[model samples]
Target chain A: MKDGLVVLDKVSYGYSPERPVLARCSFQLDANERVGLVGTNGSGKTTVLKLIVGLLKPTSGHVRIFGQPCCNERDFREVRRRVGFLFQDSDDQLFCPTVAEDVAFGPLNMGKSREEVRRIVSRTLSLLGLGGFETRITYKLSGGEKRMVALAAVLAMLPEVLLLDEPTAGLDDAAAQHVVDVLAELPQAMVLATHDPRLLGGLVNRSLRLTAGRFTPESSRDWAANPAVRSARQQTA
Target chain B: MANVIENAATYDASFVPASVWRLDGVDPRTRLIAAVSFSVLVTAVDSLPTLVAALAVVVVGAGWTGALGQQRWKRLIPVNLLVLMLLGLLPLSGGATPVLSVGPIVVAREGLVQALWIGLKANAIVLGVLVLLARLEMASIGYALGRLGVPEKLTHLLLFTVRYLEVLQREYTRLWSAMKMRGFRPRVDGHTYRSFGYLVGMLLVRSVDRADRIVAAMKCRGFCGRFHPLDHAALTVRDAWFSALVLVVLAGLAALEWA
Candidate 1:
């Protein structure tokens, strides 16, 4: 965690005090590492990603991005500009009425000129196979198209690292495969949070299982085949 | 299903092309101002002949864009029916100039004229606003309003609400289907009312949750309460010409009313 690009040390968070979702989750993401935060439903996988970008402050421990501790909102502003966050719900992220505007939101927010942002938006959308889709209404697009546009919006910012929370969650088999292919070609180091073992195979270089409040290294590539992950770190290491 | 609706939309999006008065190149700001001023003029002018002429002008001007052609009965019928009801009640109010009578009932000519004026004015204002703004991209209204010194929060609200309305509608549809699948049926009973109340309550709760997520998403992209709409709509020669045309029409209508 010390040398990682994004590090969370002893992070814990929950909506209520009675039930803490994450007790002391420790995680790290290197510059080039495509890490998968694998977990079951309601295992605080999203919380870990949120903590990294300061969307949610950790209840007890420190959250670090770019080797700087983010204790407040102001510190996270710089962190957010450099880190791209892809939410599970593409609908929530694609708030602009048109595809081009939504994609331009991030770059423009960082004070890029309209001309530069226009170029960025077109280039990013074309990269995501959404060429000539600038004027297309965000809501009118199909679910798969919406997801790609959302990815385009994130990628348009040209962030160094991506915190992708279930990028292929609602997508169909073909759409999910398309997303995986798109994500694989991206140069940004991403920490993808998902329960899908199939998604982790070619996309992620390392996998960390989030269960009960903490992260533990997972080695068995076929974890889906053997659901009973015997905490086989000793066997692999 | 979507394709069917889209086909219908495509079919209905075109109307009789009086393309000579097309204001497609006009800036939304000019359109907004013109629409507002035209609405004010319609509402203020009470002269029957003037109102009739204004309605004619409005129809011809707004009709060029073909927005007036879409869902003709669906949009106009409701408003016209409501106006008809008002007209029906207007003649019963008793007036000085009676034009017709059956037994003891008297239909006042002045009341009928007033009703016609009301209908014309209402239709003119609404149709004028619709054709002026609705022809452009719906999202541009927010940015146009923003540029016209509208508060940023309102612009953001308009943009986000317009953006998410479809999502919420889809969610509502899914919930309705779920409820129907569960054997829920509307009846004239307490159970029906309670179920509806629960449905609305659930929608509200989910909307709040979604709003929170949307805000978080916005923050992740460095949205610092400053809504910088990525629009480059400058007031061009077309806007100036359109603005001049709007002024001339309104002035002519005003002179017609006063005379």
Candidate 2:
């Protein structure tokens, strides 16, 4: 019943109790808000995204998506219908044999009619500038093309919120720019977990830095000054 | 490095091109049924003449389907080598009719005939499979299998294997390259064996992690433990005709076996 599309309140999670990955982290993603989650490796950025999507549950606190408590698989089904999560690795996300089938996967799972799934697959591919790629083999695609197809597959579901994990992790400049451009045009609330601040430019309105299982408000300039970020930016540039 | 990854990701580069095969236009369900039925028939015929006839039929079908390309021929090399090994070994087995005696080794005529029969059967089945199913993409094959009453779980397993095999291959290649860069030469030594064991362990861990991520991605898209295929398999006139032709050929082969 809140305005936030996703709200994680005082959430704490760990694979084992002795080694907590996230501790009492709280965040709110409002409608149409694009929030960038930046963290060092193993800083629990992916964990937070998983918790929001209900793949992983909080140990102590609550995760609410679309103003509903996401506590179980049934509750998550409703959340997942409104939120799409892109895995950090494109290989993990795009598991279908062909690009068309992969894109149609989400819509078809929603029990859409065959004709509607076909239309959604085609439209989603074209939206990502991947027309004529229906029969393209998923494994044979180039790195950038695979990422684009993975994103297209996510977008095919027509989610209200997008949870993207490192959308530009290993992509080249052109591919990363393509992703940035495609994402910039989307109106959905987005929570992007990435280390590259440059990828967040003109897309995410605010940045949250995760450190020691905690979130803090951070400016893009502060992130740009980090040596690792500068090196990544230079490599992409 | 990127080029290596790209090459690793290329799925079954030796597969015959669909464009080369006119039969590629046929429904996958029809092709799969025909291939499976022909393979069964090839296995059933025991006589040399009938087996040879089956091989002839396969050769003709392969030619018609344009499966005689260089890439497909390259794939047959291993099978040909195995057949050669069988020919060399099987004929040396003890039997009633000795055909050739070389000092201590006696080659029997019956054994030789048996080897030839098995080889011919193998060749027929392989050729039939190549022409009928190899030209089709794995996704189509999975769909066809699903339509043909294969268990849903098995069909999905096939699809997942086809989809992720290349990804795991890439991961292995990257790990191997890293080892090579670190001066890890693979010789017949304990270090080399241990390193390989470690590599396998690492690859397994990476694959499991990737599977976890994939499950999360699936759940995020509202996956409910069931896959819904976008394309429905419907038998058309062409499929019916293809099925009839295959049945007629199989029947002719059966008649030849009896004759």
Candidate 3:
């Protein structure tokens, strides 16, 4: 019942009922809290985000976003509007033929009047410092540029909560720094799930580790104290 | 944005069915056989009624496969109208006794009927091909082609074409966006056409460059000329039986027509 941005209460999820990937996973995020979720491969980090977005439903327990139950179509829809999900693979998320079209997709799909959608798209592109990238073909974008375009597209949606899955997954030092800077500047509750530690430096005050398909909260200091995590986090920093 | 999310939440993934046709489940070889069989049967037959019947079979087949949903059917309705128009025009190809005459238009009943037949047959062919392509990945088709006497190199070309289309579409989209940002508007003027030609020439150059980069990447990953599927599809008992059933049904339909 608390006014948390995201609340997962003992939720268990798996693609198949017989085999559970996320076992009784639970967590909560308050407004403007930058939380990091770290996990090894297949540790259900990405699955957690999908569950919050209602891309996958829990087999048991519940997930509440903005204090409303998350699984219901209506609530999930509202949560989606309030939350921006940056899918790990920008290729799948960026569906429009052109950079401008891709950024405009979420707005257009929302079906605002033409002029309003145009304004929103233009504003988002300029905000991302990609003002004239409207006509640029999405496929022609370099890996770094594509990441920026993807970020710009999500920013255009203007969600209250941003769930970023490895925003710096495939980028050089400079590109990754740009993304980190953008994340730092954004003033919203964010749950960043990443394998990279540098993206976590100075941004997150709390850390949650995904081990054996469940989240365990640890202090930001302890997360940074871990030599391995520190080394990975420092790379992007 | 909240409103949009709410709308998307109401959306169900089930709206798009996972399977497209019988070929969807069958082994690549079997799917290829089915596609080849259907394509050859439809093309070889000169008789209008036979072709019409073949078209009906494909149409029904698509529906049965659960591929003929709202989107596919929506595309078909407009196409059906255009086909009707074509049918109307066939009889009026300056034939004698263009039966019905409207202002500035004459309808030749025979030509019109013939046109209808052609249109129906064409649609049938298109429908069958779509089902095949929808269910069977191009690699599977390439494998089938290789199995059925197609040279390794030609099969490779088809595979490249299929993959290239996706890449080209993405490239074209980016290029179009770039042009749009520069306030480029498409016009019917000569300058527009000239720019369009240049765009196409650029596309070819980009495709070649992309292909080289991809080849290099693949080489780095130790890729050979051949790609082995993660799941090697084979003819199960069910697939064999399904193929038999299809052959029997098609033969029965053909016999009924003969009778």
Clashes of each: 0, 0, 15
RMSD of 3: 21.3
lDDT string for model 2 (B100-120, tens) is 898999999988988777777
lDDT of 3: 0.70
Please report how far candidate 2 places residue A51 from its true position, in Å. 0.9
Evaluated at residue B20, the lDDT of candidate 3 is 34
* Shift of residue A147 alpha carbon in model 3, Å: 1.1
Best by TM-score: 2
Highest DockQ: give the candidate number: 2
lDDT of 1 by residue, A140-196 (tens): 888899889988988888899998999888888678778877887999999999865
Query: Residue A117 CA error for candidate 2 (Å)?
Result: 2.1
| lDDT of all predictions | 0.81, 0.83, 0.70
Model 3, span A131-197: residue lDDT tens = 8998675655788888889888777777788888888898987787778777888888899988666
lDDT per residue for candidate 3 within B89-201, as digits (tens), equals 67777667668888878877778767766676667866876664544445456667877788878986875555456556667768768987988888989988887787778
- Among these predictions, the greatest lDDT belongs to 2
- Alpha-carbon shift of residue B153 in model 1 (angstroms): 2.5
Model 1 ranges with Cα > 4 A deviation: A223-237, B1-21, B97-110
State TM-scores per candidate. 0.89, 0.91, 0.48
Q: How much DockQ does model 2 earn?
A: 0.80
Looking at chain B only, the TM-scores across the models are 0.84, 0.91, 0.75
